[model samples]
Target: MDSVTVEGRAAAELLARKTSLAQTATDALYADMPELTTRYGAVGRERCLEDIRYTIDHLIPAIDLTQPSMFTAYVGWLDDLLRARNVSTREVIRSLELIEQAVRNELAPDEANVVASFLRAGLDSLGAVRREG
Candidate 1:
């Protein structure tokens, strides 16, 4: 099979494992930011998982279709939503960075690279917005 087909398959495989991946990533996130549990309790923990799951859900499509804009747009929208809820930009940046790290750690090199590219795109989008404000 061609490279594109192989990459698409990999992306599909990642999507199929989204829940576990999100859970693993959320575990890493909480380990890194324990205050989330102390500050927000069970509700906060669940929100973190849901947010990471939402990101993964959008991310797989972006990777499969080879469209960074798809993921970046979602990041932008998420940033807006979080900002409206009074979540700081630094927290958002840290969360995405940690998710990228956690997800990358779980994949093979090739798949990890694909995931990194999309995560970087999302981070870059957030960075540009941050620079503006």
Candidate 2:
């Protein structure tokens, strides 16, 4: 396969894995606190899903199209998006835990690190961007 194809596939896999993680996290959160779905309202749930979808769409493509910096930028965008929504810290932690669990289940250690680093860097970059913007 061509370099672009290879990169795209890798990025796709990364995104799929991330989506799985997010879904797992969301499921667990909903299961634990059934009220959250109601408290947040349908619009809120839709917004949250939209944010996740946006991350998978825009952020993953950036990773495939550019280098690590671009990937970081995407993550930064996600961080800003999440923060703007005022997602709770507990929710963030749950998401991270779900990511960790999914990574452990589906990826090798090194691969998992790559995914985690991308997420962490993106979050950090987003924080900086939010502060400046």
**Model 1: per-residue Cα lDDT at residue 104:** 71
TM-score of each: 0.89, 0.57
Alpha-carbon local distance difference test for all models: 0.81, 0.58
Per model, state how many residue pairs clash: 0, 2
> Model 2 over residues 41-130: C-alpha lDDT tens digits?
777666655555555555466546645677665555455566677765345444544555565567656555655655566556655655
* Superposed model 1: Cα runs more than 4 Å off: 1-6
CA RMSD, predictions in order: 2.1, 4.5
lDDT of 2 at 70: 76
- Poorly placed runs, candidate 2 (over 4 Å): 1-9, 15-19, 29-35, 78-97, 126-133
